[model samples]
Target: MPAGASTGLPLETDRLLLRPWRVSEAAIQRELWTERDPRVPARRRIDADGRPTVADFEEAISAAAVPSSTGLLAVELKADAAVVGYCGLVEGGPETEGEPELAYELLRRFWGLGYATEASWAVIDWARSSGHRRLWATVWAWNVESLRVLAKLGFAEVRSEQHPVHGTNRVTMKRL
Candidate 1:
């Protein structure tokens, strides 16, 4: 484990190893957020170009993800240790304060695989062991894959609201 991370530990699934952040993965982190995907709305991209700006990169890193863990984790392949993308806990927006939020993203090439569900389940277990009573997530309504992933993990619709950019945003939660 890295220094200063008390509960920070590695989580393994059938094909992934969800582990601590590596400074080297910063560029890949930037790619995941900045890359164009039909599922992600443009406003969330922040950069006019397909690449991340300096501010966007800084905000993604060095940000508090989970209350007690690193913000976004680097999910790599167990077979070759190649970084696929990220899935981790966050403190969440105002409506979800005091409840941890489950979040994830994968490279478009890695889509349609079961990685999200596997990695998210691992994180969910970690949160439960860490004593959280509930877990929450907010998804862009158009992100059907993520909705399926959350639902498979037992998250039910908590509410739905309009977003200036993403149309209908849905908040879902699951009890730990």
Candidate 2:
């Protein structure tokens, strides 16, 4: 289990490599925006104004912090080196102030192949190495696939919040 370059070394799994985002790959982010599930917030998807254009992602990629224990890493296939998505830890607001929250997304084409689970496992290992004892993740109720992945990773749902547009958000936690 190696950390990414920005943080130290790329986190590698049997078939995936979790690494930092590159400016040249900003277009991939835009593609993800287009492929987002309709249940995803409009702000996260492409809006009428295209709020998160390639330029926007490029700027973010260039300015990303060298995270010590949290950051999104690009998920690339070890066999072909194609970036399939991203997965990592992020601040989960006040409810999970101390414990970083797990988050992951994959291109629709790559869904159902266990990439999300595999990438998440690496991130979880990284968190444990960073001295974290617990981790959290939130998933929309309609996202059965994500719920299954979390469950396979030992995350138990602790609570749910109602969202005006996305229905219910299930908050899950796992102890390292």
Candidate 3:
């Protein structure tokens, strides 16, 4: 772990280790978010150019480490100690005030393997225990697999609207 990197709250599943962001994991974080196809069927944002500078990833890890902000947990594969991606709850924006929003992203190679669903369950449980009564997420209307993942996690489609900047429509979901 690098300076300022969190060892993370210990969260585990049968095969995954949900740990805090570590400075040592910066390179992999950059690869996962920037090098992976930006338009991959997930709801999380990815830099389209595949050129996230080291500083960019560092900032992200820092933000995730700030507990008062929103907790972002690095999802590591326990089998090999590989940093696969991230899962956590982000504080909702004005549109979703009073709710925490669930978010997760995985390396493309790890998709469709139940990692997202499993990690989401852990994060949601954490949020619930932390006193959050609702969790929300926004997905691009076309991302069917993500919609399914949210649904499987007990999220229901609450509404849809066009993004003012991206021009893409998004479907919002919530768990109550």
Candidate 4:
């Protein structure tokens, strides 16, 4: 298989390995979509028609170029080698120029085990080494778990937007 990226890839923590997505892991992506929180935007969840099916991910994995410094990395357990989730950086839009957005998602079965924080720490180090001066993360205020994780990671709330029904979306920033 191709290496995850040109650099900072296959990052290792004491219990996990941050690597590239594999074509065989399409089902895992689909699972994550299906398991999304109900409060998550509909467009982000698996639809009634099962849009963004495994085939879509297969095509994506097949066509994707080698990841750049800011690409997502698969979070996997080192003991049993099961992929738990993903964590990394993505473009945050024109306003965020040099500050990429940090993102992560883990299977429900793996929650509350410190994996998110651990994985995020690895990504943060990678981001800093990649020369990023800052990073941003957006989380729903209702997701107290994610909020706690962000807090533990040293992100400070910079802004918030209240949704009509889903509550608030908090935007946070962290200096790398």
Which numbered prediction scores highest in TM-score against the true structure?
2
Q: State which candidate has the highest lDDT.
A: 2
Q: The CA-based lDDT of model 1 is what?
A: 0.79
The order of the candidates by lDDT, greatest first, is: 2, 4, 1, 3
Where is model 1 poorest over a 10-residue stretch in terms of lDDT?
62-71
Query: How would you encode candidate 2's per-residue C-alpha lDDT over 151-171 as one tens digit per residue?
Result: 999999899999898899998
Q: Between prediction 1 and prediction 2, which has the larger lDDT? A: 2
Please identify which of the two predictions, 3 or 4, would achieve the higher lDDT against the true structure. 4
- Deviation in Å, model 3, residue 113 alpha carbon: 0.3
Clashes of 4: 0
lDDT of 1 by residue, 1-176 (tens): 24575774677888998886665677777777655564466666745575466555656565634335525577999999999898888877776766779989998889898998999989998888777888999987888889999989999998998977658889998999
lDDT (10s digit) by residue, model 4, range 1-176: 22543575789999999988999998998899988989999889988898999999999988875556687788999999999888888889744555689999999999999999999999999888877889999889989999999999999998887889778989899998
lDDT of each: 0.79, 0.90, 0.74, 0.88
Write down the lDDT that model 4 would get: 0.88
What's the candidate order when arranged by decreasing TM-score? 2, 4, 1, 3
Please write out the lDDT profile of model 3 over residues 1-176, one tens digit for every residue. Answer: 24564434667889888878888788877777554444544443454554466777777777653453247788999999988898987777876765778888888888899999999988877766666777888777667777889888878767777765444545466554
TM agreement with the true structure for every prediction: 0.83, 0.93, 0.79, 0.92
The pairs that clash in candidate 1 are 65-71
Q: Is candidate 1 or candidate 3 better by TM-score?
A: 1
